[model samples]
Target: MSIPQFDWEACINLMLQAMQGAQLGLLRLLSWLHLARDIDGQPAWPFALRLSGEVLLIDHNVVRALVSALGCLVAALLLLALAVAWRRRRWLLLGLAVALVLLAPWPDQALLTTAATPTSFHTSPERFSAAGIVRGEQLYRQQCIACHGADGRGNTPLGLSLEVAPPNLSSGLLWRRFDGDLYWSLRHGKGGMPAFEASTSPADRWALLDYLKANAAGVGVTDTGSWPRPVALPDMALDCRASTVTRLDQWQGQRIRLVIGGTAPLPSEDPRLQSVLLGGQASGAVGAIACASHEATALRAIAILTGVPEERLAGTELLADRDGWLRARNSSGQWSQQDMLCRSPLASGSPVAQVAQVGGSGLDQLIAAMDEEPVRFIKGGFVH
Candidate 1:
């Protein structure tokens, strides 16, 4: 039987499609694997998901298929080139070329970057108002209130049996925790909960947080807005600290305890020389003090130092608190609800924000605004 003519684009497309199909099948297969908790000492979430990807990658049958496709391509090319040089008939030469090209070995290029399909979910949602409270409430009512409850209580009949208790969104402990941590939970979805990362856009998630913060049923970071008469609220202690010590290895992970009233270093002993631990808290002895939230602080520092532009900072928060949670965030200044909804003390009441705004995405925009002069953020922590 005559071999088919060499079609480069078609062959490439087919190989790419096969690789993508195999990968997608592999992901679907993994979704079936009911992994028990705690495979290694580490958390089950990262281990199982990552391991699934690794395992799917090593399937020999899939590997063989990829190899076979490559081999065919090489063989076809060689035969086609030879036939063309010899002035052979178009159909015959092309067929022989394809047959020969089929002998080369390589993996499909399409498989390199796996595209995760967006997840779809359906639920009755709550709606909120413009200043952003009701809007957040509405979003929670739709996405979370079913499990957490309209009251922010965890007595949902459907969620009772779950090993992981649905957190009280209005609880003081929950709201006080970093917003990023809350955001992460919503995005990744712990335990049996499905991941809402792809489903719930970041802006909507924040709005939900705002509602949880505002109507937290008398919970959340104790809003000391109004104090008792005759006794004023303790002033927010000036946190301005200048440390020149560079070798961060000494006190990285330890939670450097700071007395809320006075930022004093405990005399009896502070831990020394720790790596930048995930949850940055100095146990009894060892400790270091970094930004409260990496998202709020880290990216800003990087931008100040690197001269990255404001617009370039991905909506992802960079500065992390001692617990590695995003207490504050340097979200994308582009079209974020916060610009219209919330105010930042750091932003100095201005909506236009930037991280590395000098050199990064905002370069063009900032450049146009300069009045025959340029400014540096060095004076403002890392920015100034």
Candidate 2:
């Protein structure tokens, strides 16, 4: 008798397909439950819903309520099934109970406790506007600089004298916390920290947060080569010739190339991006918008965001996405896409190369890459 040959390749292919399908289904389930975490261990909520023509962002609270409702519905169904089984027979009830015990979702106790803990319902009223950040910087210097230091590293002598040394505001820990939680801490004293509520107004507190976040972002990028959180480009008043636009935020829906300081004449502006010049003689020059008012404040804010000295920012170039999220920085007087600070989530987890090896100009490649894998931001934080 001849033995039939086993189709090993076909079996392997079938197994692979099944595994892939299972993985995709699990991911969908996690996303729906709002339990998915990105590479950065931050919540990866799929909040954007594309409607007929525009994209609508669902509120986080609404999404949470929906998930809770779904969970409650599932529990009710299970209870109904168990009740029906109990009425049928005592043995059936026992069997159903056992099945449920085995199949029920048993989450970690720690995670359950965390979920049960009440979070502050309040959110920052300040939208992190450039004006808010400038006010924040002033407040920070006046109130926080004593303990937190000018750089926010909490390296000052007063910080060391505390029972619990002040935390480094420039660290990623600041981004990990909710803005409301931070607000509460500022309004009411936390361990070793004094209450600011007596001295600063509510608006001032929010502005302080903006400055800390902006400072932390710059320090983070300098230390780690990427933003710790999704940072909005600090909005500032702009002076544009032959254009009605008056502020940086008005350029939303278009990419911005911000040139801080360079001796060279501004390069021909790419149609894909709007060029904004700062700290140069080309104020009224062609192909770029210039900052006429608030130049000093704008320059200082940019310095905080880049972790570069005010003087050194002259030759720096920053790239902001269409959504106004700062994405990259190039210190070299020349433009190079390889200097991207916030890499695409789709990119291989490899360090950015020092030299450009891809085809076409660096700017073109960067724009294409950005469009292909746009940054995903959730609740003021970044999801890698």
Candidate 3:
């Protein structure tokens, strides 16, 4: 008799494939489990879709509760079945015990009791008026539908192209977020979601927020207002050259023109020019900073401050006004859409119409031109 040759490599590959398939099967089952209203503790809509990229729709608290409950149920049922089988002292009793174990509903019930915490925001009541919704719907059709879909389900081709698929607006998980938080996020722009502050007015932003909320879970707008308007939006700062922290509010009243930059050697003749253009005199601005610096600490700090993921920091130039509202943003195509900064403000009376890449004489000319306008922001240092 001849010994058969074994294909160990092929067997290993097949086993790996099987394991992967099993994981996918488990994911699909969990996705369905997440769809249950009781488990998530919110209306099921967007997050009700299948799991993607190994992420879970449910939060840690819910997952922990479900696992603990399932563990107890399995243990209890198994013990009861085994005890019955032993007491009966019969093989038929053992079979019945196995059947009872198989029929246990603990896992399903555990999944049902799991809770979810959705995103939240601070918003005003007046923003949810009937007129606001109408304007928001129009804006949705014009600007949002390309990615979010007609049904606000985020099923469009553009949505699929995002690193994180655009979440369904109707999803219970998404609804947990406050309208103000969403508005702020939309204003600053993060990842695939562009900064609409450049294109959408503050009131219109509120309108869109109202529209989305109304559509989600079929909720109606309320007449009472709660959240107060902010005194000033939060300021942002990043470490610049010479170890100084460049706060956006510092340039509040200046004619600043920030550019998406990288490290450049300073001119030996002017040591103050650490890659700065016009040296704060001609431009009436404090020069510039490299967008993607070697300063990881600065980058991380900006991420924490802005609530923007660290991954989106590269190749973005963020601009702001004296009052701390991000006035404009420019980007190089190196990073993903979600990482891009806000575009120029869309307010009709905004100073800058489009984000300009001015330098040298062009920067000097823009600064001189902007000098005619009254300064609305100031962190104080302005050179005569």
Q: Which ten residues in a row have the lowest lDDT in candidate 1?
A: 227-236
Q: Candidate 2 on 252-370: residue-level lDDT in tens?
A: 78998888756655555667887877765535534444333345578888888888888887767888888777887877655566567775442432333422345677776666656
Name the runs in model 2 displaced over 4 angstroms: 1-103, 112-121, 280-295, 344-358, 377-384
> Comparing 1 and 2 by lDDT, which wins?
2
State the TM-score for model 1.
Answer: 0.26
Off by over 4 Å in 3: 1-121, 125-127, 218-384
1 against 3, candidate with superior lDDT: 3
Per-residue lDDT over 1-384 for candidate 1, one digit per residue giving the tens place of the 0 to 100 score = 999765433333344445435644554454557432321121122221211112222354544655576678766777677777877476787876665555445444523322121221111132222224445666777777767776566779866777887876555544233333455556677765677867777567656655564445222222322110011010111121253333222233332222211123322222321112111232211333332222222322322221233345333222212321112223342322232211212222122344324444332322222211222111101111
lDDT of 1: 0.37
User: What's the residue-level lDDT of 178 in candidate 3?
Assistant: 38
Residue-pair clashes per candidate, as listed? 64, 1, 15
Top-scoring candidate (lDDT): 2
Candidate 3, RMSD to the unseen true structure = 22.7
Against the reference, the lDDT scores of all candidates come to 0.37, 0.64, 0.41
**TM-score of each model, paired residue for residue:** 0.26, 0.67, 0.27
After superposing all C-alphas onto the true structure, candidate 2 shows an RMSD in angstroms of 11.7
Error of 1 at 87 (Å): 4.2
